[model samples]
Target chain A: MKAEAFLQCSQCKKILFSVEFEQLLRVCPHCGHHHRLLAKQRITATFDPESFEELDKEISSLDPLEFPDYEEKLEAAQAKNGATDSVISGWAKLDGMKVSAAVADFSFMGGSMGSVAGEKITRTLERAADAHCPAIIFCASGGARMQEGLLSLMQMAKTTAAVQRCRENGVPYISVFTDPTMAGVLASYASIADIILAEPGALIGFAGARVSKQAGVSKAPSDFQTAEWVLQNGMIDKIVHRREMRTTLTNLVKMLSWRLVKHG
Target chain B: MAKTWKEWERPLIEVEENIEKLKQKAKASPEAEREDLLKRVAEFERRRDNYIEVMYSRLGPWEKVLVARADQRPYTLDYINSIFTNFTELEGDRRFGADHAIIGGPAYLDGEPVMVIGHQKGRNITERQYRNFAMAKPEGYRKAIRLMEMADRFGLPLISFVDTPAADPSVESESRGISEAIAASMLKMFELEVPSVSIVIGEGGSGGAIGIACASSVLMLEHAIYSVIPPEGCAAILWRMPDKGAQAATALKLTAAWAKEFGLIDEIVAEPKGGAHRDAIEAAGLAKEAIVRHLKLLKKKSGSKLKQERYEKFRKMGRFLSENPVDALAKTR
Candidate 1:
């Protein structure tokens, strides 16, 4: 019997065997850091046991830009990931606190943000607000979906406004930064979270660190743009291990629950 | 038996050497010149201390500018990490590819759960490449929108760190659609149903920075610069010369102090004695305290109330008392 193969680290160029990587949940054994997982797996891990109620799972994108072979590319990605669009939105529980979540699947066209992703995120936030539940988003993307043209970029403002409405409704919003969060996503709601978190060794920034090097800036220190660096810079609230996320979130929800009960 | 040179005839070096010799001789022959040498050394020490104190205390604005731009300055990420713990990163927009500009994740502050986001610059070449010099691209903004929406669903407060020159403007970026991404981010941030706070940790430039900066309360580091355009870009556009960046900086009111004075920023986090760079740990500590304090106050409100206040804050950004510039110019004509 042939063993399954695993993906390699895009940075250190280390190839991880399938079994070993899977045991670690795709996290690198050598690095002891988490790696990007499929959107489905992310949802499974983040939500309470058997608590995910998916929404808008059928929404997909069209080739509005008419870019050559764009449809074929989308089709290929969908076939590979078995998803209609790059984003998946749903209702779930984090530590028994009802919440809504939307995750972008990076395997689909490099996880670029497009019209569909924007709509899904907006709808998710709206649902969370309506339900009076907190919202949690797992962002993994390349940037604006180029095939969508200006429509993709417009999602920044549209989603930002959607979240604004959520804020007005007294809902809690949390953003989780992973490796390679950048560009338009950084400019928009990613940087506007009330509490932000990052994983160790994850590359995080708006511009590529190389751009600064090209601009004649000094070299980055070891760990620069890593989760530790962000934490030091006061951009994130904490650096929780992946395994501890559910428990940490539960504690937070419990506190919020107490406050709500007392006030309401 | 040696013939002694008079003090006026001796060179300064010779005089110092002779004084040292005399001091030695005083121990054996009771010489009178020893006291004078000690007095001169004491006077030099006093003068050196005075000069150093005076120079440091009277630094010029230009010099302060240099200090402000120092790369070693402690920023938002440092402070947030220190105060908050147990962070988990979530990556990618799942559409194009991963961008290394913007960072967001889940973390805990003072044992409270929250979500965080920020624009991070690099401390070195490799890191700068990873961070794209903190200039976000379309994906970065989109990712932020995704995160905010999640925060709303989870009832987690949001904290944003603004520190970027601007959005990327490469041909590839334009081809990829930059403006729409920014617009979407602005719209989503305005609608998020969580208490949000923004801190300008370094350079908050243009819509790229503002897209994620729509918060209930916005704060800035003392030396951080927040402006619609970088001084150099402003100079190139207004004066047709990049060398006039200093003038542009002054005119733009980009500094934290200026923004505070203009009511564009809610507060200014203080830096260390020489600047944040000189004492990053201390600087981060101070910023963390401020963030915690703000977050605590915000947690008191319901998600809906937080959203309302956040919307009102953005709505009031440019609502100062002033006549229309076009009308004033017409009247002058």
Candidate 2:
């Protein structure tokens, strides 16, 4: 029997070959629905070939809380995902424009931001500032990691402070919100960018839809928390398709980089 | 979530109850014995007060969390009433309707004009339901952003009181873009050139707490607990059970003492004996003094300098030295 080399889209349920899906950058060909990608996939699709120089590859989360099964989970995630943690921070070139980049991998523990993930992202920005280059980060997460407890939550402040330094130094920090950006990530650094961009139909919010619905708070519009809905409400700058993302970011970097040059 | 201090402090409360019983007995007893009974009651009261002082000094981390979440504790408004004068409350996000969870407006702190914002929990079930139990909605944060921007325009010092379990995790808040609203508030806060200070009066839970807490000087009440998520939530996630909250609370180090030692907060305001609920006026006084002192220091700096300092201050948090960096590198190999 032939192995199942094809996968089905979660949204449209269209069966497509894995190689074809990879070539399309994981966006559904039939329905145009954007699928969440791994950290490496995001980096490869977003940056020029071999231009990425990874940073802080040695950092991983410690069980500061000594939470049961947490270390085991981290080890299992490392073995399964072939990555250190949820986020991949590095320096990469977008259309030949040098910029520091950090892409979150959703497959790694739902891309939760713990202390290490937060530190890596912060260090990336710090390195970017020292190197005098703009920084861009792709945020795809289910908020703060609960196992790390408050230590995980502090990342929100840590990353936000890092963003603050980038701005103070007149560095352009662009945030690209993809798929599932919610809770602590959205509330802090990911939300405060020089330019905020989102992919089509991303679930972007502070609270989960299910939790909110269970509480019986109030009725929201049908399109609530969707990228388009947030864009209409004027929270994000624009909605870029997966195909046009790299070029659009490249153009933005060129324009913002000039401001840094003129002022410097 | 209720005012259960009587039950929680059985020994002390029982003594107070005994004093009440004795006072009634004295009213009916002969005049000769009344004086002696009254003296006994006074002594008992003194001992109880001392006990409270001792207990407060040695409170466990979990016990502190309980004190931080006590309903009777002074909330944002209570401090505002005692600390500020001539408060003119301004409401609404302008783009949306008003959110009652967060209250903000222009006010005078120590005779100096300032903008005040805070999470306000209610005193009763009805009020809690109305205030969303101090968990802010999207509109609440948007309202905060509007006020922060206004404060920046007028160069008014911004003061915020934090007290909440978390931002309202209601569907309506998410639907209205709660995350974006919080983000906008944080960005606006860091951008503001005016002096900013935050006081954690009670439960400082998660992004809802930090939304209004990104300040140059963040102060927490002695009994207050500030965490990324409530201990119960942390326990449920980590232990896969709700009963392990006490353990989770200890591990999180949510107490003011730990926060100050770790440099997460600038200062720890002393609460009156038996916690802030025992004496709201004294707690408010301490908070006012701390705020005034920080504001004085902050006022000396330029707006650009203030922003830069606040950024640098937060950037310095959570520094650690790994016992073995080689182990981490070897793992990747």
The DockQ of each candidate is: 0.05, 0.46
Instruction: Go through the candidates in order and give the clash count of each.
Output: 170, 1
Residue-level lDDT tens digits of model 1 in A137-226: 877776666555434544555567767656766777777776666655655666565566665666655445554344423455666556
lDDT of 2 by residue, A140-251 (tens): 9999887766666667777877776787777899999998998899888898889999999998888777666766547766887889988887789999999999999999
Alpha-carbon local distance difference test for all models: 0.67, 0.84
Model no. 2, DockQ: 0.46
The prediction achieving the highest DockQ against the true structure is 2
lDDT of 2 at B244: 80
Worst 10 residues of 2 chain A by lDDT: A209-218
- Badly placed stretches (over 4 Å) of model 2 are A1-4, A8-15, A28-33, A126-133, A165-172, A219-224, A228-234, A255-264, B1-6, B319-333
Q: lDDT by residue for model 1 over B39-91, one digit each (tens)? A: 66556545544654454355443334444445665555676666679877777
Per-candidate TM equals 0.49, 0.89
DockQ, candidate 1, comes to 0.05
